[model samples]
Target: MPGSLSAYLSQVEEDGADYVVIDTPPHAGGTIDAAIRAADLVVIPIRPGPFDINAAAGTVGIMKQTGRPGIFVLSQVAAVGPEGDDTAAVLQELYPDVPVAKARLGQRKAFMQALISGQAITEFDRPSSKAVGEIKALFREVRSRL
Candidate 1:
């Protein structure tokens, strides 16, 4: 873990990166533990589902235990539906101390296509894609806290 953390931080520092985003696995592991310890802020992306919500709780617990600040970003949300709101509310209620991002990412084909095409959503096709906007907004929300 030290080797991994050193390599990861060295690159970010050497490259003069403003932010380093680490995507942890669904379940708890050594990598996640190291990340939470090394992170300035943790971003937990949760889907509006029973399993996801349950998993997020465990992640949030790790954050709290480590005395690390974290935020929840509701991912793959419906564009116009009650599920997003209801899920956010439930999450907030469950973890009152953790902050949830107002900028939610809706389920979009552009996101999947961007991965398949090996390109960013902003670079995939249309510059005016809502997926791009959503990501930018999420970045802003995360950056503002830092």
Candidate 2:
């Protein structure tokens, strides 16, 4: 289980998987480090706040050191406010080269409800809802870039 990230990635490649999404913890750890180093492109999901932004800076540094491209995805952002824009501005100023995702996943009850139901947002009721649309758009962006 430990130290098998590379092996798992190899297996995915060998199996011809279309996409490999590895979710890493916010803090730096061995597994996250290994995943960032091995990732073709790293997606760092950050909340709209100073602390989260700062934390992501450290991770971005590691991605840069590994010579891997990394993008920022603003998660659980409030829809009706300038806070998300401000946060995106801060990230853009900090990492001018890194692309800040245009698609922001707004904080909604649907996501939590889906989690409680042990299903993905798409699998939840009202698959054509706005919540599902945002996720689908985000996925398409990530997929196209990859």
Candidate 3:
């Protein structure tokens, strides 16, 4: 994010690119504004926790003002029990137009293990508890929106 991502995005579109993804650090700034200006959609990742869900709302507001769609990905959720309902209710209350699908990335030790070893979950161990299944499902939803 050296300058406005919008500047780069403008250049890419001029060159006939279909899409561009710009990852900025977890903060709001000139770079974020630029990226928002350039994007058709914004994807905000929120852990299934109160604080994280609140943060996702702020991001969605930015996208709304910028005339871009903002999607939420709930991560680090408990695999079972009442926690899912709590998180889902919070999201449903906020951005009902954007579908918060039932699929999620649960909290798991294997994810941390893979990250520590500098490998993707699929590349490190596809068969370990099958979190890839969840990731794949999430990707499909995202793809359909795009």
Candidate 4:
């Protein structure tokens, strides 16, 4: 599987693809390792909770093993609360090597609504919507890292 993934990623690069985003499950395994090996930068999403923060260690360990850089993006964060900030602080304290993204994806109906409507938040919601802005900010952060 790793060989296949490497081959596919090579083809994607040769085909002039600007980027190939690969989403993997939280647990560690061959596929996850292979994806990490193939990735230039890994984006680890963490919800605002202790369990979620602890679970991220495995992926962070894999990234370390492969000597690849990664950034943590807080997802499904509460719209009004310190949970998001506190979680980010804990993550930074625990894994000082990995940076946390400045943009937090707040828990919003638009995300689910867009999925149900088979459209992205950028398309499903108005441009000025918070969800749309959050998505755009995340894109910028990820792009800057790449």
Candidate 5:
């Protein structure tokens, strides 16, 4: 039962959301199988590290099995120094089918600040320029997917 799986696809259809951002557990469990089965497009978040890139091999294959288009988002990118570029370069070679060409969501303290205050980044700090820019660009990018 490698690719055979069960998910809330029927409920998702009924939920009527314009998009779904599924956060799967970090393993090939029933949950991941379910999400893959339900997803129309899989966006794999990659951290710049050896193990992280290796993990993506399984991720790419799993997403492909669902017959869905996929993309990779480089997350936790401190800076594109040797380590970051090296990781990205290797990932490109590994999962050529998945687009690893999106803007990196920089690791920002604002995210933690907003989370601690129990607010979305948009509402967390109206005057914080960083939060405003990140939220705006994030929405714009997501909207482009449609």
Candidate 6:
């Protein structure tokens, strides 16, 4: 099982896949290790809360150990509040080497609706919707980093 993920990723690459996004659970394990090893850029999603911020340290540690660059994207952030900014500041202060993304996914119904419909927010929501904008901006930032 240790090398299974790597082998699968290798096959995906062989099949001309442009990118492979592996969403691992918020815990330490062989699967997470393998995913980190195979990643070109690890995108860590952190919610604006004390527990989420603290939990992210483990993933950050893994990234450092693997020497893989990563960015922290704020997820499910409130539309109007200081929590998002405060969290970003804390993340930057705690991990000066890693960058916190400017684009944040806000807490909106569109995201849940998209999930229920098995579609992305860009596809499920109106083009001019804020949720769509947030996703697009995040994609652009992630693309630039890659």
Number of the predicted model whose TM-score against the real structure is largest: 6
* Candidate 6 per-residue lDDT over residues 1-146, each given as its tens digit: 65778788889989999878999987958878878878889999999999999988888899999999999999999989899999999999999999999999999999999999999887899999999999999999999999
Off by over 4 Å in 6: none
Models 1 onward score TM values of 0.93, 0.93, 0.80, 0.94, 0.77, 0.95
Provide the lowest-lDDT 10-residue window in model 2.
1-10
Residue-wise C-alpha lDDT for candidate 2, range 49-76, written one tens digit per residue: 9989999877888887888898899989
lDDT of 4: 0.93
lDDT of each: 0.86, 0.86, 0.74, 0.93, 0.70, 0.91
Q: After aligning candidate 1 to the native by TM-score, how far in Å is the CA of 85 from where it should be?
A: 0.4
On residues 3-53, what C-alpha lDDT tens digit does candidate 5 reach at each position? 333334446568885766778755857667677767776777777888778
Which of the two, 2 or 4, has more TM-score? 4
- The numbered model that scores best in lDDT is 4
Q: For candidate 5, give the lDDT.
A: 0.70
Looking at model 1, the pairs that clash are none
> Could you tell me the TM-score of candidate 6?
0.95
RMSD of 3: 2.8
In every candidate, how many clashes are there? Answer: 0, 0, 0, 0, 0, 0
lDDT of 5 at 57: 75
Off by over 4 Å in 2: none
**Taking the tens digit of each residue's C-alpha lDDT, what string does model 3 give over 1-146?**
63645577668889998767777655666677777767776777777778877667656776778788767777887878777678778888878866676568888887789899999787776764568777778778777778
Under the 3 Å rule for N, CA and C atoms, how many clashes does model 5 have? Answer: 0
